[model samples]
Target: MRKSFCTTAILLAFGFVSSCGVAWSADAPLENSDCVKCHAKVVHENQADGGKHKTEVGCLDCHVGGHPPSTPKEDIIPQCSMCHSGEAHFELNNCLGCHQNPHQPLHIVFGDDNVAACNTCHPAQVNEIKDNPSAHGEFDCSLCHHDKHGYIPDCMECHEPHRPGQTYSDCITCHRVHQPTNVTYGQDIPNKDCGACHGDLMDTLAAGTTKHATLQCVYCHKDTHGYLPACQDCHGDPHPQLMMKKFMKCTDCHKDPHDLVK
Candidate 1:
């Protein structure tokens, strides 16, 4: 009776082992399609606006090992550092603060205090404000870029236009946002634009009968904001040597460059 029981037990054990081997062999490896079955929303978001992640990577690439039942929750969700390393921008903490959605990585949203993070990625813009100090530079980056990560606020939002109907395009023509005080413009700038600040001077030049009255403000001012040219630079020694020595400066006789006392 004992010999018969042992033979039966051996046969049952062999049968169980054979069945398990067949089942394991038949099972397929996990794929992105498999992940999409459970994580449809996440997959959709990634597909729509995941930036480099959508194009360069796959679901299995970031999330390794296995899914929830087999893998720990922490192990399934990969850290940003795993791929984004060796850069100052990558070193910033709490990436989710600005990049609120990991799936839609490029759809960034800036927090109230994301200036530090902004400086890491855009040091040139930050340095421009630092190198040339102004009232605009004193405020936080969020103050102006309050809407989103890459939002550019209109100058009219904070400042009234120097003159009526001056568009935002007109603001950038002379004022660099980072270094607004260090005003600069091109030769094409009209006298009216300059008159926005120098109203009295524009009026004086307009009323005068001198040749300077007909010329554009940029003709004399050139590219720089507060540039003052010497009278001799344009009219080099207009008078004889004897007269030049007596009246060393053109302004001495001419009185004012804008409206010369002819």
Candidate 2:
């Protein structure tokens, strides 16, 4: 009878606190920044400044309305749909799951977030950036995609332009969005995946006298994978200087610059 009376007393106390709008914590869970310390710098690398984390908006402020497990990998973070009521995008698809980190929140490189995301407005480089394996694989999608849907970023808007010979008239010529690793060449630029576009180049390597014939175009065009070679850089006497001067344009004599000495 005494134990039952005590249980009733505890229930009445809990209800009174609940009715008073006061929260009862198991213990005060760590604030957002405190969580980041042990969680490492993996969550929000970009929000170091006056953004969400710096504003003292803790993890519980955003990761609310869900019960995350005690384990790290097993912890299911609350979806953005929970408290991101102020923002709007497509439907939720475990955004933070595939997206991985939220602190940097926009650098998606896996599927089509790279060159193509920018191409919704910058259509010029869409196809080329999509094909280059080296274009999208290395970087984060949010690095270039600073805006939401259909928003275009000027080249200098987010990043600086190129130098002397390296400047790209079309960013897609060398820059890819989806996977920085898969780049395609342009119209003026001869395509040379060796197997994909330059099957002829592969055939020559297969039946050639030189061992180099066995190599792919990308093998020689290393460094920046989307980059091509200048005939002037390699073989000193690759062609007659006098004839080259008269032509002014190398494509006239070379047919396809990638084909070379045909």
Q: What tens-digit string does per-residue lDDT give for candidate 2 at 1-262? A: 3334334544664432231212213354445544433344544464553254435455566555433223343344555665565432325344654455565555443444544434444455554544555634355445555434335455656455443233345556654445444545434332333344456765665565454444556555754654777666665567777867878666676554444445
Show where candidate 1 strays beyond 4 Å: 1-30, 244-252
Question: Model 1 over residues 65-172: C-alpha lDDT tens digits?
Answer: 765434567888989999999988999999877778887787777767766788887889989998998997888898998847668899988899999989999899
Q: Model 2, residue 194: displacement in angstroms?
A: 30
Which stretches of candidate 2 lie above 4 Å from their native place?
Answer: 1-37, 40-56, 65-76, 85-88, 92-94, 108-110, 113-262
In candidate 1, list every pair of residues with a backbone clash: none
In candidate 1 the C-alpha lDDT for residue 191 amounts to 84
Error of 1 at 235 (Å): 1.4
Which ten contiguous residues of candidate 2 have the minimum total lDDT?
A: 16-25
**Residue 116's C-alpha lDDT in candidate 1?**
79
